[model samples]
Target: MSLVYAKNDWYAIAAADEMTLGQQRQTLLLGTPLTVTATDEGVVVRDDQGKTYPYQIKFDHVWTALGDAPRALFDIPEGDEPGRRCVPCGVVRVKCSPLRAVENFLDIAHFPFVHTDILGAEPHTEVEPYKVEIREEQDEVWATKVRFFQPKAAKSAGSGITTEYEYRVPAPTVAVLYKTCPPKPEAQDVIAIFVQPRGEEECDVWPWMALYDDESSFEELVQFQQEIFLQDRSILENQLPHRLPLDPKMEIPTRADMTSVAYRRWLKKRGALYGAMTEVA
Candidate 1:
């Protein structure tokens, strides 16, 4: 895939706690070297030549962009809801395209194979038809009515149960999953995946979750989310081509891949070529 980083959107670089007073951290996004530091005023971000860029602190992370941002960060209303545990499950670095990481998060077919009994089991390997669409008003891709059987849908689950899911792709490298919460049957557990494209072939993924469980400790909640994402890391790193192919002819899509297909179309429509492949001339 040819690399063409999207510069006009907010990308989460580091956890808020990672940047403390008098501390400085350096990272790369879309091949651009970035320097982050904490000052008396607030967090500051600059480029290699000391050119400062605009940034904001939200959802427990430092977000910045390389070019003019057309909009603010995507909102997660659940983050502000009382009694919900807003947990940040550290970052996981993978040697794959950021698009691939987001696609994997939107896929439930892999649950039976990659996630095993925790997310799915044999005999329930079938992925029932779901709805996928590009919302013109919001300019985002949405997948709804997705259902799956999970032995442990969340850390607070006591037994296996059927989990309903809704996936939203608001950006090229970001996706959020809303799934059934056993403890709070009326509400859904929100899991958001934010990918920072370190390069065309590599990325650092940050996982955040808002759960209704008050029974689990903070450490346990983080560990539970980490365990699930780490399992996906292995599978993502081993996929051939490294970059995601935007052309449908490059890979076959089945009923289960509706979300992924819609995502590729969304990216292509916006000319987002970062970590993406186009037809060779």
Candidate 2:
């Protein structure tokens, strides 16, 4: 797999709390060196050569791009809704391709095997049929009416219940999940994974949430998300081929993998080749 990246896009490299006042923090995104420093007014970002870059603070992280002409970041309307508990679960560095991480996040069929009783259990291993499609208007992949039985859907969940979910992939490196909120039955809980490409086979993933729960503490919420992702990290680090294979022949897909197939096609269509294996010349 070649180390290629779509440079003209925003990626979350560091947590908002990481930028200490007047202290410069540096990192690598898509294999480019970048730095950030906190100030009284705002955060300042610079390249390895000390040249400044455009940046914004959203979803409790600093987003910036390496390419000179970059695409605009997507908006998360739920981030502003009143009474929603916005939680940043922090970052987890994984030794796997960023694209692979996003693909894994879009899958739920592994719950019964990987997540076990926490997310699913035996006899409830079947993944019901769901609809997946690419929305041309937004250039995003969407999966609707996804339902699964969970032993504990969330930290606030008091008992096992069938959970309804919707998945959206707005960017090549980001995945947004909308699921049923236990407390607010009429509303949904939004959880997202922002992948910061560090190298072809490495990335720093940040999980965030906008929930309607009032029962779980901030620490509890963060811990709950961390536990699930850490379990995923183990599988991510050990998968063969490191990068994702866009060629369907490289790896077969099932009905449950429609979102993944849609994602690969979307990446191919957009030429977002970082951390991917494609047959296209």
Candidate 3:
């Protein structure tokens, strides 16, 4: 996992709000040379060789599945309190697995079963029409779009209305999506999460929330989404492949496995496509 993480490619470190301007800190994740600096215009990432890349803190959690040991580097200024270490890069790297399994989870069809409690459709429930899009390169890398029809009375009454929760992956480990209610048909709410694979079997999960109408509302949403991530992290890390099964018998995916099935099929096709292209070339 660590080897694939390019020192040159722009990788997400932390949220912009966490670090102020003109501040530099050193971190250990992704190697000891990692350094993060905040400038007036924006943020900059510097390698050991003084090579710097200007960037924006797009995701809240810096996740990786590089090496066998997963670690998180939180940039705490030197002048903070006692027992505080300033993490220049705020790069949290965990070893969960390669980026592939993470991609499979986003398939709308899998939510109904794999993650039944938090995200899923009841048996016999038809999923609202949604499109699987592969947009621009810099577009949300890992993304999902889903919508479901729900009864209006059940929604406002806090009756756990039937709704669609769509998640889009914009990077190797970022999830961005919308959740909506009836009457107010607009998807005004968004949840963005970053999952870094630490080593080969662990992961660091960070989640942030924001409203499309009000961006600043991210403050409270951050806390709310973080808790949900905590729950997800606990379950994901415990399950095989971090909530995925290497062997089907251990966890059988049924009709609700549509999403996972689709994802697997896509991956296979991608592999074949790339393989043929390589051979032909």
Candidate 4:
């Protein structure tokens, strides 16, 4: 019998800061050499020649990393129309690697299980699907818009948290995003975007930004969220064969694996699937 294995997460190779204009970097996306460049106009990426390409805009406070490379932040042109428009979204483009980790992490279905130490510790919790909107300009790499919502009774452990998670994945390395304003005045809200490698084994993380509009203090709220991610790293980094292999029956997933499973399905459909798909071999 033959079993095909895939990865459940995506690996980030470099950040915006590590790339230079007209320079090329090697990446592991589908075991392919993905090249990125910073140009006078913005950022352009090519695979195996001038074919399959897209250009991005450069702006201030923009940072990114690619496959074990250093991080780089760029300066945007003054009064530049395109640059100005692209800055708020935080990213102009991104390349979904073989891991499909980006979509997996965001799949609300797994929150209660995979994140048992954090969001999943409580009972009867689930993420409600909100909306997904996408827009791609002519000759653009890929532009995606996503929205997420949590109902009032969704978070049993924490207080009722309701807001939209918006994202614009402009490049394989950039994400522009923000959170919608909460209807209630006393609630806390955060708008943020994160681009990091699947695990410590990979390289740079893109510009990670967290913007807040609510009045609740940012101290504990930020720390709480940060700790959750850190916890994920601690566990994910220690697993055997950190990167996904093609053999399906190498590992075992327990009851807490629901989130991982759902995320895997999400990425497979997006064409960025990765990780070992096994039932405790």
Candidate 5:
């Protein structure tokens, strides 16, 4: 497994509301210990050696890069849409590679087995053919036209429906999913999963959502999202080899794994070795 992390990228280190003035918290990103402090100026992140790094507050989180950043954080224009609730679902720590966490977020074939009635159910386990591509203009991976049957697709969903989905990987450790919204059938609910690599085989995942829901309370929405991801945590931690394999030869990829394949290819092309195993014995 390659322990080299692509440092030239922004990673969500802490939720905005979690950081208070004059408070300091210790966290890890890309296996580097960091001291995060909230000040009048803004949130400041420092390495163990007391070297301060550049930081930005966006999407209700503090993002920082430990190396020379290639660009700023990816934009989510939908968050500013009218009548949408931007919910920060909080962080989930898992004993697995961050790359694995992001890949799992992009998967729909496991919905029936892992998420059950919430995201999928038995007898409707098929993952229809989807369009996967690498947009050279933005240098990101996108999977569209993905459809799947779900019993309770969202917190506002009143009945089972076939959810149309679009998955986007803007960064190595970040993935965004756009799925059908029950309340607003014309619009889609946005769920973004940002992972912080605490170690080569461990990470803390932050899930943020923007939904057009007027029925569910804030607490109810958070609980629903948390329950769904907690179920996934079990499967992620139990997977063999912990680190994700970048080589297709290391693990067979079926038709349903097209998104995963594209993701691996994107990572390999960019030479992202952190939390990636190029070969398996």
Candidate 6:
């Protein structure tokens, strides 16, 4: 099996919680083994060759690159706002391509079937038309005007409501979603998925959130988000071919897949080949 990751981009290598003093851990990234150590100066990551790479801690994870990154890390404006709880939902390692995992996040039609009554239920599986465009300036894909009915959109949600949704793909292996906040209808909640590719068919996914929820405990928030992803993990790991097909003809798409189409195109246009199927079978 031959897989090529986008070498000129940033990826999350470790979580902040794992950087306890005097602690050391080993993990793989793009098929390379690295040693992660926590020291007085902060966490340091070095490869088997003893060469250490520069890293930064952001959104509760350690970000690094195997090659010289061509672009700066994307920002999360909602994360800087006041009164919003910042919850880093931790890591979920899956036996699937990082691209497939991301495409799954940008999908809403599966909520009723995969997430069940929590995110959606029977007779409410219809996904409204959404506007999708690629921001040429930033080379990002965005989808707007999305609306869906949810049984329980958030832990703070008391009942079902029509949720307003917007999706953004600022990076190939990362996706951000803006949805109606149950606690504050005027503002939206931000949920981002940052995937760290261990290889072509495996990855570590870090889910982070910036929300207006004050009622749900931190533990409850983590559990709720993890549960949602665990539900997705079932489909992610079992999907045929494992990697995401960038070719539109490989898998038929409906109107509800507008954002996914844009995402695949953006990936292709940018030449981000990590965990992507570029050729027809």
TM-score of each: 0.96, 0.96, 0.56, 0.41, 0.97, 0.96
What are the runs in model 4 whose C-alpha is more than 4 Å off? 1-101, 113-121, 129-158, 166-168, 173-180, 183-201, 214-222, 238-241, 244-281
The 10-residue segment of model 6 with minimum total lDDT is: 1-10
Model 2 CA lDDT for position 213: 87
- What lDDT does candidate 4 reach at residue 265? 38
Instruction: Mark the regions of model 3 whose C-alpha exceeds 4 Å error after superposition.
Output: 1-9, 25-33, 39-42, 48-50, 57-95, 98-157, 181-183, 196-203, 212-220, 241-253, 262-281
What is the lDDT ranking, best to worst?
Answer: 5, 2, 1, 6, 3, 4
Winning candidate number (lDDT): 5
Instruction: For residues 1-281, write the lDDT of model 5, one tens digit per residue.
Output: 23333677888989998899998879998888999999998888999788989998878888998876446678989989989999999988999999999999998999999888889999899988999999988989999999999999999999999999999999899999999999888999999998988988999999999999999999999999999999999889999888898878888899999999999999998888798888775
lDDT of 1 by residue, 1-281 (tens): 22433887789998998889978988998899999999988989999999988888877889998876446677888889998889988998999999999989999999988888889988788888889999998888999999888888899999899899999998888999999999999999999989999998899999999999999999999998899899999889998777788888888998899999999999998887798887632
Candidate 2, 1-281: lDDT as tens digits = 23334778899977887776886778888787887888776787877788887788899888988776787899889999999999999889999999999999999999988888888889899999999999999888999999999999988888999999999999999999999898888999999999999988999999999998888899999999999999999999999888888887887899999889999999988888899878633
Off by over 4 Å in 5: 1-5
TM-score of 5: 0.97
lDDT of every predicted structure (CA atoms) = 0.88, 0.89, 0.42, 0.37, 0.90, 0.88
Q: Candidate 5: which pairs clash?
A: none
Regions of model 6 farther than 4 Å from truth: 1-5
Report the Cα lDDT for candidate 4: 0.37
Compared with the true structure, what per-residue lDDT tens digits does model 6 show for residues 1-281? 12333765778887888788989978888888988899999888899999887788888788887775446888888898999999999889999999999999999999999988899999998988889999999788999999999999999999998889999998889999999998788999999999989988999999999999878899999999999999999889999888788887899989998888889888887778878888797
Q: Which tens-of-lDDT digit does each residue in 57-144 have in candidate 3?
A: 4333322222233223222122133421212222233334424335444545545444444444467256655555544443333234
> RMSD, each candidate, Å?
1.6, 1.9, 10.3, 10.3, 1.4, 1.7
Error of 2 at 214 (Å): 0.8
lDDT of 4 at 214: 36
